[model samples]
Target: MNARIEADAAFTDWMQHVQAGMEGTLDAYLPAVTEIPARLHQAMRYTALDGGKRVRPLLVYAAGELFEAPEELLGRAAAAVEMIHVYSLVHDDMPCMDDDALRRGKPTVHVRYDEPTALLVGDALQAQAFAVLSGNVEEQYAARQLKMLHLLAQAAGSTGMCGGQAIDLASVGMTLSLAELEQMHRLKTGALLRAAILLGACSGKHLTVVEQAALEAYSCPISLAFQVVDDILDATADSATLGKTAGKDAADNKPTYVSILGLSESQALAEKLRNDAHKALEQFGNKARRLHELADLIVQRKA
Candidate 1:
């Protein structure tokens, strides 16, 4: 029990360190508030810095460390992935989409700024993400970084996150099958997540076909597990706890794991996916400890 407690403490310490470091990394990459587009840059900084669980960035760090990627490379990759994620959130909370007022325990970008400003924030952030991913890297890493940029684009493009959002908008008030629901989330939520893991691993060195396959298998389940836990929390937790509106799925009459499978079943599926995620990492042994810990964190997070 003491050993388990100590392990938990260590993971907590590591998580906090990465989360804090990301603030500086993201801040450095973002345009200064005094830039020519002062308001836009300010809103960009406001939305990107000092908020949320940075799970995608943590995933990038954890996966990159597996292949012994350089810290500089990992930082750029993590920041790029997070920029795409934050931009999505900004657009998602607009009146045309989820239309929520709160995010990361504060007013969302659309609520804090006008809709037009929010629109530009998302667009500018999306452009900046690619620029950061592709810039300031050594000549040796240029080739790999270009491919990483392409991967990030696909994940954020019409066939990835945007595609998923489209499905979600269309899925509202409709009864979707279990398979259908999973497919939607795989693109919507999972694509970027998969990108984070792959980007991290690729940042270090060239991967063998087997290495790539193993990482793919590992990402598949955790991606779904992330969304399952999210649905569970949205159904059971409160607005204050979630830092956003709770029960929004039901309120919007959207399909979710909880709504389709019931609360208990959704919880069970999350656990099963957690197990699958752990199993997929067996080939990496202790090298994958951080990834394993992250799987648990994603499934067990309260908010």
Candidate 2:
């Protein structure tokens, strides 16, 4: 095989390993179905376990591996970030939000269970994420772990994902400039993704100001590109391919890259962002191979 094919195979192996390992890690960290609130616990597992691309956790592992972070620490951080991501999805699918009935090819939490259970599931998962991240903190890494916790909270709270989501709700049926759309997604979609990378890097050691800046620059384009590709997929792909309702954004009349830039332009924008993501990692060289591949995957994925 060619070198490109070799690298793709290696990355496929690594991706499978991480995905499988996260299943066990999350299962162990989550509350048991037999826990006091059995129904709520079951719902939490239903929404969180065994679904989706797990891109956030994959980013966590890739960044963590780049920094030579400990495997155990990386696992905790990965599971924590994924829990937060899943919680956001749960809430986003509620009638109060997107009102979707399917996610990851399964009935949404609110659809499978009741609205109240879904709400509690999201709440419980968020709390569980912090609990897992905060548990078993070593004295040597206490300060660093504390910072990780703070970063996650900031990412999930107002001024981050929640703020972006609020803007999305209001933007329906309204026209927004490209700059405005970028700003909203920066918080809603990019914040947690940025946090996933930073949290993984922080797990290994302290980051120099320069290193942090480079990582920040790299994250900016990749994060936005992820959303750009999502817009493209939503516009063109089917629900079976996407594992969720397709054309929902257009159906809801939400402003998207496709709506604003046209399908071809939106696709070109995604490619440009992917290139930007690669350029930002030039300084990191081969150490960022996984990150480079991830950037490609984000833009090139069919769903």
Candidate 3:
């Protein structure tokens, strides 16, 4: 595996640029701090604006940039995807789900506020996300934008992230094969990551079948590598660094790549996945540099 590092100042600068743009958009979409339903709106803003890596939005911008997509469309597309991601995290930390108390180095929604407020916050964000993506766009890209909405909806519904979380809840304390584990993560983690790429690409123009197939190739391994790294971090990193409970997977008896494959093999698998992601993007050459850098970040991330 190449494992090349783009550790230059430029890489950090680009990441901040994307993060800042999406962060500002999110703040704008959220209800005002003193809205009529002030408490619910406050909970929503608290979770959405608190802090996160915003990796999914970055992927949207990067892939859209590949086809010279319109900045207006791309910005909306990124914001919509990020809203869904934030909603998922809000519910995931609720009492019925992972029941986490801390997230992103702060109190989880349900922890900081009451449980009912947290529930409504998640529900509102999910609804608001689709509202952002429902408008018309460039004539040539109109159909593609609709397709992006469907992709995100399906990714969030029973067949995608929600379905994967169901599997996760059901599989606790039960043994699973590597293939089964991959299936779970594919829906849970991979679906959103893949949608980010497709939604971004769709924001620009229609991709030839061959070009989209290449994006799929890149997204599959890239998504899996991300989860593998998460598993590794859960085992090795601290709560302060991770911004969440460390070693919670083992404590909950949840199955993870590291749990089944051991630390050494999981690390090796992450490297292999990164290599596959790069190989899939070889056709795009320098145009895919952001994606290639993202794949490396997913695997090499410490938290």
TM-score of each: 0.99, 0.98, 0.96
Cα lDDT for residue 277, candidate 1: 95
Q: Which runs of model 2 end up more than 4 angstroms from their true locations?
A: none
C-alpha root-mean-square deviation, candidate 3? 2.2
Compared with the true structure, the alpha-carbon lDDT of candidate 3 equals: 0.90
Candidate No. with top lDDT: 1
lDDT of 3 by residue, 1-303 (tens): 233344445677898999998778888777797888999988888888849899999899889978888987888788888999999999999988999999999999998999999889999999988988876666776777788889999999899999999999999999999999999999998899999999899888669999999999999999999999999999999999999999999999999999999999999999999999999999999898898889988888888
lDDT of 2 at 159: 94
Per-residue lDDT for 91-132 in model 2, tens only? 999998999999999999989999999999999899999999
Global Cα RMSD, each model: 0.7, 0.9, 2.2
- Cα error, residue 195 of model 2, in Å, equals 0.4
Q: How accurate is candidate 2 locally (lDDT)?
A: 0.92
* Local lDDT at 42 for model 2: 90
